[model samples]
Target: MERIDRRLGLLFALPVSAILAGAFLAPLLVVAIFSTMPQKVFDFLHWPDFSSYRVILEQGYWRSILWSLGLAFTATALLLVICWPLAYGMARVFGRFTLVLTVLVVMSLFVSENIRLFGWFLTLMKGGLIEGHLRAWFGQGFEGLLFNVPAILFGLVYVYLPFMLFPLAQGIAMVPDDARAAAFDLGASRWQVFTQIELPLAAPGIMVGSLLTFVLSAGAIAEAKLLGGRAVIVIADDIETAFTFAQNWPLGSALSMVLIAVVGTLVILGLRRVDLDAIMGRRR
Candidate 1:
């Protein structure tokens, strides 16, 4: 019976594994191969090398790479500030109210990012809802505020906030009420309980949330392209330009390879503190 069950499990997993390879790993391998070749030699039969990476590092590409990193890190930091308390509030409360609120938050994630950005565009432009309110309250000096970095930041936060909240809610929910009671019973102040007990316990969730938010925001081209216009250029946009307009597949592939390397390094560092295997529930 055990052997049959094992065979059945492998059978079910085979298609999924094949799909993942074709969809993800195969493309990545192709990209890696292309990144090492010259643009003229598009043939996969050619040998690969590091010439593409040399060009990437020795050009103006670094600026866009830095900008993408900055934007992603900033958005992730802002998300932690905004979503932690919101997640805590949702998790702390009981009843249908929490259910309704959770549904709303999840619904925001359902809306396409482009649609959300367009909605914000109308809201934040001059003579729009936000502008009208600002003019009425803070006066007319608030002009030219929405079409730049602020808009990009807002879009990023709005899109990725749910990713931050869900993990945090899970972490906070895992904190037993009895544990809180025991901490309080041991003469721990509210702040102490939160800082020393609650936050420490929830660290893994926060780390995961930050990682997701940062990576998504880093690779985000639509938000920056639409909201930021040409005022701000991100690495992903640069890659798109290389692939589409510049027709420089090797350079674009190289940039993507660099991004993959950076993200992999960060994930390795993050996994040091958090039990990644446990977090991913792979323990037998």
Candidate 2:
């Protein structure tokens, strides 16, 4: 009877396992294949060469790379700063309000990122809401504010806030009430307790959330296009240019591989620092 039950469970799991292998694993195999191919090669897919990777390593791609890294880190930093207090508040102070707040966050997440950028574009344009306020205060309006690095950064944070908030709040939720009480009982200042105890316990979740925000912001194209106004040439826009105008699939593919390499390397480094047990415990 036990053997029959085990066989039945395997039968149920087989289809989902096979779909995962075929749908996801197969494309990864193709990416691995193409990452090693030459710039002009077409007919031969099996041939292995490091030429594509070499070009990626030894070329002007470095500038775009630095730009991506800078944007990603900046976005990560902003996300942490903005979400930390909100997440802590949600976990500690807003028990009955948590569901309502979570619903709003999820709704914002559902709104398309491109659409959000569009909304900001209109909002930042001259005579818009923000512009009206600035015009009243400083007399010089939103012209300088729109189509700049600041707007692009704003769009990035707006789009990625929930991603950072959700995980961080969950992390804070996992901290023992007793730990917080004990800290208070020992006469630790609020700042001291948060900095020393809460933040350390929440580190793993913060890392995961920040990594997500970083990767998303790094690859973002629409925000730079709509907000930066061609002034800033991000790596993602370069890839789009390669694909659309240059019509260079090989170069575009190569560009994408560089992004993949950079992001994958960061993720691997982060994974190495995370304790698996701690991560699982946070989920509980």
Candidate 3:
């Protein structure tokens, strides 16, 4: 019976495995092949070389890579700091209100991303809602809110907050109420209970959320384009320019491979420290 169940599970997983190979791995393989090929060459008669990678090693290109990494890291860190307390509240303190909060978060996902960003654009624009209100009340308003680095960061945080929040809430929710009560009964302060118990138990979710936020933020082109204007140049923007405007597929593929490698390494490292079963509330 157990053998039959195991075979059935494997059979069920075959479709997903095939889909991943075709949809994900196939594209990556194509990108890898193209990354090694000479740029501006569409012919089959071409030699694989490191020229594309050498282009990426240039000072200007390297700066874009650093910029993307820095933005992703900063945004992920901020999300963790902001979401931790919010998730804890949703999991423990809010009780019936948690449902309302969850619905709000999920609703954001249903709205178009571009529409949400456009709303932010209007809010921050000169003579828009924020400036209008400020000018009306304070007789002065700042007009430098849009088309800047801070605007891009704000948009990114707003868009990705829910991704971090849900996993963190789930992790915190899995912490046993009895364990918390026992800690309190043993004269442990609330701070001590949270610091020593809750935080440690929620580490897996924190890692997952951080990885997701970092990966998404790093690859973001739309937010940078809309909010950053010409002041910011991220790796994703560079990749898009390379492929589209510059007409350099090899260079674009090289940049994409580098991003894929970095994100993949982070995910592997995070997974090493996180227990999937624990995070999913599943028994082995």
By descending lDDT, how would the candidates be arranged? 3, 1, 2
| Cα distance off (Å), candidate 3, residue 188 | 3.6
Give a tens-digit lDDT track for model 2, residues 1-284: 99999999999999999999999888666656665666655534546675766665677766777777887789889999989889988988988898899999898768788887788887887777788788999887646467777778887888888889988887787778899889989998998888888888788878878888988888988878897786677889988886578665556667787788889999899878766567566344
How would you encode candidate 3's per-residue C-alpha lDDT over 96-213 as one tens digit per residue?
9999999999998898998999888888888888898989999987874888888888888999999899988888887889988898899999999988888887888888888889
List all candidate RMSDs to the true structure.
2.9, 3.0, 2.5
Candidate 1 per-residue lDDT over residues 1-284, each given as its tens digit: 99999999999999999999999999999888889887645667767766778887788788888889999999999999998888888778755677888899888878888998878877777777787887888877456446588788888998888899888876776677888889999999999999988888778778888888988998998888777775688999998988888887888899999988887788778868885554454443
By TM-score, the best candidate is 3
The positional error of residue 191 in candidate 3, measured at the CA in angstroms, is 3.1
The lDDT for every candidate, in the order shown, is 0.83, 0.80, 0.87
Which residue pairs in candidate 3 collide? Answer: none
Error of 2 at 43 (Å): 4.7
Candidate 2 matches the true fold with a TM-score of 0.85
* Residue 78 C-alpha lDDT in model 1: 96
Candidate 2 to native Cα RMSD, angstroms = 3.0
**Candidate achieving higher lDDT, 2 or 3:** 3
Better of 1 and 3 by lDDT: 3
Off by over 4 Å in 2: 1-13, 40-49, 57-59, 132-142, 275-284
Q: How many angstroms is residue 257 displaced in model 1 relative to the true structure, after the best TM-score fit?
A: 0.8
TM-score of 1: 0.88
| TM-score for each predicted model, relative to the true structure | 0.88, 0.85, 0.91
Whole-model lDDT, candidate 1?
0.83
